[model samples]
Target: MNRTLHRVGAMCAAHPWRTLTAWIIALVAAVVLGGAVGGTPRDDYDVPGTASQAGTELLRERFPGLSGTEARVVVHNPAGGQLDPALLDRVVDALRAVDQVGVAGPAQPSADGDTAIIDVRYTVPVTDLGADAMDQVRAATGAARDAGLQVEYAGQVPEGEPTEGGLGELVGVLVALVILIIAFGSVLAAGLPIVAALVGLGIGSSGILLLAAVTQVSTTSPSAAAMVGLGVGIDYALLLVTRHVEGLRAGLAPQAAAARATATAGRSVLVAGATVLLSLLGLILSGLAAYRTYGFATAIVVATAVAAAVTLVPALCAVCGRRIVRRGRLDVTEPQRPPLTARWAARVGRRPAVWAVLALAVLLLLGAPALTMRTWPQDAGSQPTENTVRRAYDLIAAEFGPGAYAPLVVAVDLAKVPQDSVPALQDRIAAVPGVATVSEPLLSPDATAAVLTVQLEFSPQDERSGELVDQLRAETLPAGAEITGVTAVFVDIADLLAERLWLVVGVVVGLSLLLLTVVFRSILVPVKAALVNLLSVAAAYGVLTMVFQWGWGGQLLGVDHPVPVSTWVPLLLFAVLFGLSMDYEVFLLSRIREEWLATGDPFQSVVRGLAATARTITAAALIMVVVFAGFMTNADIVTKMIGVGLATAVALDATIVRMVLVPASMMLFGRANWWLPGWLDRLLPHLGRRGSAELDDPADAAPATEETASLEPAASR
Candidate 1:
């Protein structure tokens, strides 16, 4: 063992209670401070500073009071053709009474007649719409319904909120607890990881809130951040505790076992945490404010999990060492011929190349479906189900003219154009394809800009909506000018995101590959890791396409049929699932590497690593799968996509990649598995020695004496 590890191990043996108490105090303080801080939900679009952002900004600036780029509420009743006069008056009164609404009116029906649309706007900045705002909308909708008029509210605000209530978060924690219980078969043992995870989540969330107080972090960031923290936090504790138990089974004194576990398992966790944090940080390359907030918040939570795993977890283990060891009579005796792990290690030493190729082939086959993946544009009430809001929207389209959601606002700077050209520009836009109706240009109060509301023949969420946007940008708008509106803003935002898609993918894949290479110290290993991870992600995307896009099992999944996939969900899921899958890969490979290093045998190493770690990995994966599946119960389309995508990835990664492909390929690889070249080997730094050691001299290797040594406090790396 290294001098630093041994020193820390000794300290853990001496004063376990003191160590545990300090960690408890720190965690409590963090939680208390966190509660005082609150964060904002992030907007999904990339607002301007770039060309796309500038385009979006121009649209918003030109439109002024036009629905602010988000979906707006247009309530009416079709049962009586025109709303009943009394109901119309009541609806108008209700609309005017809505707090924070910028513009409200019981507007006259179109030239065809028989429909009345109330244009209700928000008083606060449209970007401020969040959980609180959604709640207010829900309340207002209910009130409108009570007034004897049908009501429908659809926008980004309502769609973003998780529809499964709090079940997703609750299920995540519960599933983790159940897995830990089965893994350890002890209440205290199982409970410890959950406690650690809770503390980590509390601290991470509080930190985000505090950070948001100083800067802008989106509201959605917190929920996603919390999920990431809980998973990684519990997984880290599981690794540490499992190691400690193994040490005890090796006949070491309780304190000694705990200390050894802290030194070794704790170090691996710190490395893994750093890698996850870095991968999350890659989101900054997205160049979108919303994505940036997600990156920063998720990175902070990952850091917190690392701290809790290394310091808090070890401290607790130290304090409860004897009790934990004595509570269950776990077998720890060392076996003849090193150990089963070592024996299996010897088999892998026989062949390594064949195993590598088989794994690669399987991964490629699974990843094939990603090539055909498509993106869905943002639209009001487009959450894959035909809810009341969507039904109301459809009725409006049918009764009134189409484009009832919101018109594409084109802003013309009349001051910059010749007086004769003003009429011509208006005529040009009115003639554009899909422009069913055009309102006379309303000059801004300043008179510098003229706003023209052009209602299209298609719904705002329809593919034609995007086509209309493109047509305006390409054909309607003349040179040296701008056009802006809800459809235009969304189209521009989508373009910006699409442009940066490759960069985001590159950053995530590049950083992950770099980290894996550093950890494994081999060129081929990192490449293999990246391939397998991508394959798993591709397979998940395929399942999402089948379930969400094709509407297969939509009813069972609590979603409506044939809903387009959310534009942002796939990107978000890619980043999230990539990090998570890498985490599992790292854990499994670290064990395999440990055994391979000891025996210099690839086949034996594969068997030992799988046999020793498979049960734990499977248990952990199931916990995550259950948590993700719980999100499927949400009525929201976006949440459902996230849930199903994540759950499928976890299942496939755990069962196919980890159990089948990884082992089969390793069995084929032999000694070339660890054959890093001399120069590259020299450049890569070795982290530390593996924890378990066989007794070369029985007496010397026998369990340490009753005089327990204590672990030194962990220093931040």
Candidate 2:
């Protein structure tokens, strides 16, 4: 890895303009290809082979008209407190004329006659509803407004989202830029990292768009990539730049400094990026389309960041060259001998057990609530009142039964049961406890299946709703019928996820452990890394449950009611957080191991390694936390939950896990931290950059030998 990075660095530095021109061409080509062939984004939560999935499939195949996205156009008179019947008729007429939405059920006025709700259905999925649908929606709402009534839209496409733009991302980047400037104290030095990161991510975005041609990609994929890519991308470059600056101060020539930095920090980037990629790619084991899609997209972006960091960053370093050095910065030659990070590391080494215990205590306190965390699908009920979807949800729950938001369909196999008993089965289902309303039976074209829609007393997001599903499936299902719907499918999905999540996690964790064990050639290091990351993930979940589910700070976040944690959140969090946290471990441990190998001293090595990487790691963590936190401002509830969860996990992992626990654990472990049995060492692939460098140039080992000798600590000497 080191030799490869050095070669890449040497080539880029030798011909910087060629490297720059190649990157520019690649970026432009990617964008052009992406725009030409990208698939349109869609929102789908289909859990295949589940009862609900079977029912929905049947509906789509047999009755396409009834299977599209549903919307409700609601009108209310605020001043008179009475819906004008004539005005509602006019509004309905305008809506009926709209090409996008087809009125489903008749206009049903509230019992009080003050408000009326019209059921409208779209022929496409909610995510597929384009500008034409919006224009039609505007026309319908305009009609209601003309009649001096309150108008809002709900269901298929939400309202009050004027532009669904990435304003939060822009704000985060701006803040991150400010942070970088302060951290480096040189505009050009700071800007190089950002530029490198953005250029890489730009190509990544285009790549994702092009991938849309071959498969379904969620609209959220780009934003998610942006959030993660920005932080990792910049950090990868920043570490290289930091090392290069140190190299220059060590009296290495310009090109030599860049090459050496690439040989060191660049190797760390490759390993870290590879781990993140593998961990994420392993999510394909989930066998779910959405998870697999997100996993693939993220993996590709991370790969892009790694490639650019190894190649483009070096070229850019050469391009900026001496211009990046300022009078008080490089010329002033700030001493790296006794950085504050090393001092903190020294304190930690003095009482390794004490610091380790304290960090564990904090992790336990934060992670405690995760044991009781409950996950379900989020509905509009949890949204703020100002949101059109929430308003519509509240009105339905108020005027109709709470279950109106989610009705379960009981699909009966009439062939399996006596066909004559269909009516009797419907009657029995309606008589079931907690069933508020049951629709008349609808027979399949062959009369072999009968479907009945049942509205329960509880909303789909309610725990009681899950209980209702369990009751019907276990106790109340009439001989031939199985309940299925949006509510039922989600319940099944949540249950199945709960059942299989451990397997997926085990696969990823096991894979990561094996990879790290081989890379680091130590059993305890991988074990310790996994344990700390797990606790960090747990604490992140606890924070999510507190804010989104436990209702600790709901109001401040603009949510009126506590939402159930999205069922897939924990699984997604586990994969992403584990990989990302491990990236930090890779960075820190690689340096520490490098030092240990050089100095043949464990205690001093830990201190020097910690001091060396701490500032860059902290800055990296800050950027990641802020970027993720910014995503919480999005109106999408799932995105916000993930945003908060990831931000907390990264922050905890970076500080508590990286700074306190890891160093302390290594300090306590001493020489044993690097121990590997002879047989195991022989079996494992050699991961040291020095070995790879020598292999690359059998006759060129002298230069690397000289470089290593120059890097020896003065204290050790």
Best candidate, TM-score-wise?
2
Q: How much is the lDDT of residue 436 in candidate 1? A: 87
Please, what are the lDDT tens digits per residue for candidate 1 over residues 427-448?
8878887888778877655566
- Tens-digit lDDT string for candidate 2 (1-717): 677677778788778889999999999998888888766555566778777777666665545555556667777777747776777777777777766564454677888887788877666555555636656766866867877787767764553233253377778777778887888777887887888889989898888777766776665666666667777888788888888777654445556677777888888888788778877787787757777877888877888888888888878888887566563454443465678888899999999999999999999999898887899866678666766788878877887778987688887777676778877777776888888878888876766677788999988798898988888888767555667767897898888888768887798888888888888888899999988988998899889888888899977767777788888688777878888898899889988887887787889999998987888888888888888888877776767787888889989988988899999999999989888899998998886643223434333222434434444334433
Candidate 1: global Cα-lDDT?
0.66
Candidate 2 RMSD to the correct structure: 3.8
**Candidate 1 Cα errors over 4 Å, as ranges:** 1-32, 42-46, 49-52, 59-71, 78-81, 84-101, 106-115, 122-124, 128-144, 156-168, 322-329, 332-366, 384-395, 689-717
* Weakest 10 consecutive residues of candidate 2 by summed lDDT: 693-702
